[model samples]
Target: MKTSSRLEKAIKKLYVAFHANELNPECCKHCAVGNILNNTDSWKHLSNDHGSLELNYVGKVHQTLGRKFNGYSPLELLQIEATFLKACGYQLPLHHKNKKPKSSADKEALFNGLTAVMEYLCKLDNINNIMDYSKLFEFENEKPKYQLPY
Candidate 1:
């Protein structure tokens, strides 16, 4: 998906904050742009403190090019991750409006795409959850294994 410049810049600022010790990396967990885009908790904290950093950059090529961000708490970062995951591709059965169910091939394609993207992000973070994302299709009970308590 083509991301807005604002969203892109906001994401970059969040990363820089982590690099500069201005923000705690642990708070953001997976700090990569892909992860941040896929996860909402990080975006929320960053946005709440920084005020729609993404929206601000939507109009400019380098909105957050060199700015420092502040005010993210650990819990907010976690929330961002959850939201991002949902946005990226966590399917909601209820949201399926069409009477037609997904074909096996379609299901495979969706699962494969989500797994591929998530696996890539995990690799960037050196996180060991690649298997988790890859196995999301077969993951029973629709429950995430590493369920961080809110």
Candidate 2:
């Protein structure tokens, strides 16, 4: 499903929030920017047979949003991706550049990257404010070690 301009903007916001929080953005292997987005090195896989916590986190996000959309909607899937990355410490580097070409392909890449980043930040903000427990299911790691919500 093609993302609308508003959805793309939401992703960009996520990237900015992650950067402000000092995290770097990670990419999905299935996506266009997967090569540049940070890979899952800092995080651990809970179990080999169960497909790891990361996959489970993704699935949880899909399931949570799936109920609302009646399956994995593209935007919801991207939002879920962002949520996990945020929990796993995936953030957007302030110095990172949007090297997308002058085409829709570039737009899509930008949209995906930013979308994932933004949703994560949003969930974090919600959790910190005690407003939403929407992300509790997808969180795989312990609470931030030294980081405090500010």
**Tens-digit lDDT track for model 1 on 43-71?**
43333322122332322322344322232
Q: 115 in model 2: Cα distance from truth in Å?
A: 11
Best by TM-score: 1
As for model 1, its CA RMSD to the true structure in angstroms is 15.6
Q: lDDT for every model?
A: 0.36, 0.36
Off by over 4 Å in 2: 1-6, 18-21, 24-65, 68-150
What pairs collide in candidate 2?
11-114, 11-115, 14-117, 14-118, 23-91, 24-91, 25-91, 82-116
Candidate 2 lDDT over 52-146, as tens digits, reads 22335544555556542222243444444544433333342211352223332243444544554444434433423222345544544666334
Clashes of 2: 8
lDDT of 2 at 97: 54
lDDT of 2: 0.36
